[model samples]
Target: MKSLLFVMIAGLASAAMLVSCGGDGSKASASGPFGEIPSLVSDFETFSDAKRAELQGGGEDNMKKILGEMKAAEEKFKESMNAAFEKVKGKEVVTEIDPELPLKVVTPMKIEDISVSRHLVKLVGELELTATAIGFDSYEPTDAFELDDLVVLSYDNNGKPFAYDGLSKDMGGEPMPAGSKVPVDTHIHIESYNAASMGCLSKILITLKGSELYDQAKAAADALKGK
Candidate 1:
């Protein structure tokens, strides 16, 4: 009886030692009220290998489900990345000015202020572009300085003509005296520009032509040069 009592006491002591030594304070409880639910492992590194395996559970079906969820999450992330990449690639490039049509050509008729927005553009400049006839003794060459005819050429990012916009100025061939100057302001509504090659107008070219004075002015200047 004493031996039996000793054996029972030894077994109880051994059980207590085992319980105290191997305890990790955590208790086994289902993550949810139901059974297993597929979960996203945001920080898989935080869990031990054994704990992670236990969370995944022990079945071919469970393993497949976990892998499928992870794969789906990875694919979703990749798709979003690709979408952002495409947006960056398609972003519009800005153009400052058209080199072929420099502002210096209209020297005295300068562009004072310019504003651009997503929808429209506003431009302010001198209306009357000065046309100096070097050696014209008569006022016949003065009409070219009036700029009765003005044409605008709008270009896109690719330097292709997009819109043929008209200025709001009322020059209308109103006829100005020799060396007369006029100031003008104009606005262009980009949305209203209905052209085949139109996307975003990156450059604008303003041209003035005095068809009648072209040969006459050159002849006067050449005559003066020869003398």
Candidate 2:
């Protein structure tokens, strides 16, 4: 019973973060893949709360029914997200590891898969990394260069550049040793209206974090606000 409650709470938290909230205390109209998320989350919350309260009366059949409902809702949510992601499956983006950058890309980065929900687009891929002399200087030569010290930039079809929302790699916090090729799984986030257009990206640039290029890209992405 406790385990079921924990799962329900976790699902709620995950769903809450996946959608945007309106300023007023009302459900915001979604414009992307997760259009039904707000209502789904609300329904699940209400249903779970009612079920939890009933569980206090100790009914095994009630608990089983709750579990079945939870699973159904979860499957429905996944189907919605999966269908949305399918719209962008074959679209390819040209990925480039900036030559002037300190980090050396031993393997070319490619968009192996994509996932979209609401305004967030996630790009997944694998790449190999090694540090150069310049990398050493930029990343404190003695210490291992961490994957978190990487920056990603994406451009639309019109060639307008924007900074990505965030990046995550397999060996995230660990130091990337210099002169050795290390394979890292990468997941990058970018904000967009839909998966199709975002998947058809013109280009993606990767550079060292905190570089001047990153600042410029961030500024460009930020300037799009209100427009």
Top candidate when judged by lDDT against the true structure: 2
In the predicted model 1, the residue pairs found to clash are 127-182
Stretch of 10 with least lDDT, candidate 1: 33-42
Q: Residue-wise lDDT of candidate 2 within 1-227, one digit each (tens)?
A: 99999999999986663333321223433432223333334444455577667668767887787778767766775676566456544434456776764355555454345443333444455455545222223444444443446667766444656545444555533455556454433454433322222333456777666777777777765664333
Tens-place lDDT per residue, model 1, 59-169, is: 877777766665665565445434433333222223222232212232222222222222233455553334432212243645233334344554443454434444444
Candidate 1's TM-score reads 0.30
Off by over 4 Å in 1: 1-120, 132-146, 170-179, 192-200, 208-227
Q: How far off is residue 137 in model 2, in Å?
A: 11
User: TM-score for each prediction?
Assistant: 0.30, 0.48
Q: Top TM-score: which candidate number?
A: 2
Please give the lDDT score for candidate 2: 0.51
lDDT of 1 at 72: 63
Question: What does the lDDT read for residue 135 in candidate 1?
Answer: 19
